[model samples]
Target: MARQTASQSTLNTDPVEQSPAESQTSQEAKKAPAKKPAAKAPAKRAASKTSSKTAAKPAAKAPAKPAAKAPQMKDEAAKADAVSTAAPAPKPAAEKKSLARRKRPRKAPATGPVTIGRSGFTKLKNISEIRHYLRTSDTPVFFVGATAFNLLGLDRWVRGFSYISYYDSWDGTHPRVFCPKDKPYVEFESGEQINNWLLRNHEVRAHIERRTPPGKRPQVVMVFFDEETERICEELDYELILPSHALRERLDSKIVTTQIADSVGVPSVPNVLTTVKDWDELVKVTNKAKLGQDLVIQTAYGDSGKTTYFVTSEAEFAAIADEVVGVEIKVMKRINNRPIAIEAVNTRHGTVVGPCMTEITGHADLTPYRGGWAGNEMFPTVLDDESRHAAVQLVRKLGDRLGKEGYRGFFEVDVLLDTDTGDVYLGELNPRVSGASAITNVTAGAYADVPLFAFHLLEYSGIDFEIDVDEINARWEELASEDEWSHMVIKHTTNSVERIDAAPRTGRYVLDHFGNLVYSHGDLDWHLLTNESEAFFLRIYPEGEYRWKGADLGILVTKAHLENSHGGLTLHAKYLIDAIRGMYRTTLIEGDEPQPKPAPAKGK
Candidate 1:
């Protein structure tokens, strides 16, 4: 799921007494109602302070109840109880049935739209209204994930926004980020595992329960989740605001994506889906499709370059036979292509597409695998005008089809540009917010209107909205042509199990005249980065963590293109990688080292 950020002052100005359930009525109120005098301001201040403290404190800290703040706590508790039992309001029958089917527990049904501030009941008709609603919303939204990189800048746009992250990128200094301090040694095999572990942690749960307002369920979003995540969210009553895990899993499969694309008239690379038990069967399938001797085979699921296989000779197939044999694989003719990633949202209005970016993949200096996704670059001319239009159209079609298939919210598609034929082929679908979102949310379109993910929120926000999808797309295309942005995910590449004694801080770093990278300043997000000389680095494996082979070290964001037109690392990109790597210092764990030989010295 994609999260959004709004300004804090607007959000903290006045509390909306309306619940999400109460925001459905379309009635207009009578005019000439004089505004009442403002209520005591101290109470509001106290509540804000309490909420901020709870949100900023480390999860491991014991819940504090200072005597000086006791009265404020009591006031908050009273307000919560009052809101919960206020009334049993009426709601639209259809909306009632929908909420009931969702199995969400609420105190009452809403009869009419509650007035917000002194604005009375007004419908959200434009992007500006939507932005105002989000900024002023007091809803507690928790984006739980491995790290907060994908949705890092969201808090800036939404009040009461916070990130529950497993990786403490800010070392607990970030006011909106909360990472638990007591993590035990556990081998995490996937992003889901990390999220589940964080969800189950006592401190994390306490943090969520503490900041959530009374009579309101907290909203949770993540890039990777499963049924276990759903159950955990249910146990805590945190609204998992994304498509069902089962639906996402089904759509996540490469085979399923191909079928959906085909159904919507979106072209994928010439391919055949079949179970390959041996090299002979693979050959037969490829030959029947006329895919020739060289082919690319992919399993239903995997990340980066792990599950994708490329083969030409029997020897090459033999090495990965164990993985492909008896498994359903997508076999395609290998093409000389440039990989592109585009993010889109399935909104009630329609599907909204983000900028198309050139994918930086498999650079040995950045990643260990041949086809691994290391980063992405977003700039004008990534594709010609015609090709860009085609790619956007294809993504919109896929997103619309996904909505028809009972899936909604944020999704990313990998499209391959056939250099020979100028064709755009759907490569795969990531049915969730991905690493590419860092650039997607901060593009020229986002500044002019809103990020693609905000539309995802509107779909779930239960508020009616209208947009000219074509106009937005055309304007975004023009703005994207003038915008330049790039980001790289740096991973620990050495085959060693070492503990990080010191790691680079998560903030802006500038390249000095001597080419040395130095800390520029502390910042919460990279939107403040003004030039290529300065980059915002979000650290993943902080000090005291084990840095193993292929472990993510951090992420680097800049305005410069990291890869050239030929798909090789630019010289400046290489320099940035070396300088960033030089910031980390690690020492081998004691148990992993050889024992000393004292006996030989004594005998001599």
Candidate 2:
């Protein structure tokens, strides 16, 4: 296998950098300064310069000085001096108007449809206006990926919204999904390759062109994209709604996330960022930091389940020495922890957080890798009031800090709840649309208001809007305890490869009296699922496809918790897993037989 390029491997992007157009405006603002009112009062001129500097630096900490103490005659004299200087060099009315225009803030161009043309777009003042704009506008928006799992039902909210995917999960029946017919077998190593292939395909290009108007650039979005993806979008003249790929690569580093969290007062698990050559150095580093004997080691990049190591002794360290030696890693003290997953969107207004969900990981029946994320569970009483509040604050602070770094869109973060201490610490940061988004968008809060993703789209929509983020957060917090939902990503857990002869269909399933899962009927998405008995299964590998260890078979979304009060799989959850796996019939691929093609990468 060839080495993976940075573009193919990167999984994160940021929220704090200014937009390109905003940066250009800031530079132009600095170029022209208002003329000094008076030359006589050098002290006043110095004070004015200080004020300008303060305005330029949003994070400036300098305290403002009190107004100058001057007698009535002195104030009048200064005013007379200013009038004299201005009277001598009075500018033309046209020049005065131009300067005033330049001084005023420049409005950004509309990212969605421009109803007002050069005059600018109508600012969406409230949630009602935002919902109306999205529903009524005909702007072309496409979510390009291998499958529409992360954002499956978003088309119902936004007009002209379509999904351009490589896999026909809906068997070409869904109206909003576009899967090209020219797809040939290709062993893709990453989601980036799958997206690139779809973008370059003739049929996909034609599909996009057919829907797009003349001289308009259709919008393209994906769960995973890179520099190559950006280049393709540029070549094809499509607007990729994401941050710069370079920024993503930088923030993808675990070390960078830790540092940023420290600066913003977001607590992380006690850890040290360093390079270790062998077990001795590893011990020495941990000893100095007072990290316990049990440690969690993580490489700067890669799937955490595959790259992260748990070591308690020299023997354990020696086993993975080849991969960890001389490499920069984050080593932390291991603790009894329960991981929580939450999604948030960092916007110009503020970071709007979603409901917190308990992560289901390391299930032997669901995944072969330990610590591998299998699914997420959300329920009204899953979390106590204290844990939920602390988790929300951590995510909100982290999002605000990232926004300061110029990242202004969607991102997911893992918060580790120390079961022993009840403390919530920042875990891994996934600076992209994550697997948990499916649950995040359908919570009671989302139904009452808008989905958390609506804020992300608003940021990129180029329309000015304002809302009380605190109010939204407060409402979401209250509503989180009023709903129960769960979804699991079921993968092939066996070691050997096999060819699937028959598989479950992509639709709703109900359990029969004999404890079997029966396909109820065809459905577009899981939004309409009514009860826990009915589960929506979205298949990734249909009949005649190959399944290997860790290969995703399908996703099951249903109401109620898949996990129990004791943090174990419930009987119904076990039944659903067994029944679903029983539905697939596969034959083992023995030695000497050709190996099966690899599936496209799924976003975690």
**What Cα-based lDDT does every candidate model obtain?**
0.66, 0.65
Candidate 1 C-alpha lDDT tens digits along 1-604: 0100000002122322324322121111112112211112111111101010001111110112222211101110000000010112454676434322222356476587654422243567777777777776667888886567777786666665678876667766677777776654443433455676788777777777677766667788876666667766775667899999778767877788899899879999888999977888888888888999778887766445545777889999999997778877788888888888888988876788999988776778865556766677888779888999999999988988998999889988888888888888898887777777788888878877877777777677656667788888888987888898998867655444555677888899887776667888888788877788889988765565545445567788999878876778888888788777877776653223523312111100
- Model 2 per-residue lDDT tens digits across residues 479-537: 99888888887776655555567788889887667656788998878887778878998
TM-score of 1: 0.80
Residue 502 in candidate 2 has what lDDT? 76
Candidate 2 has a TM-score of: 0.78
Off by over 4 Å in 1: 1-107, 113-122, 589-604
Worst 10 residues of 1 by lDDT: 76-85
lDDT for 293 (candidate 2): 77
Question: How big is the positional error of residue 392 in model 1, measured in Å on the Cα after superposition?
Answer: 0.3
Candidate 2 local Cα displacement, residue 520, angstroms: 0.3
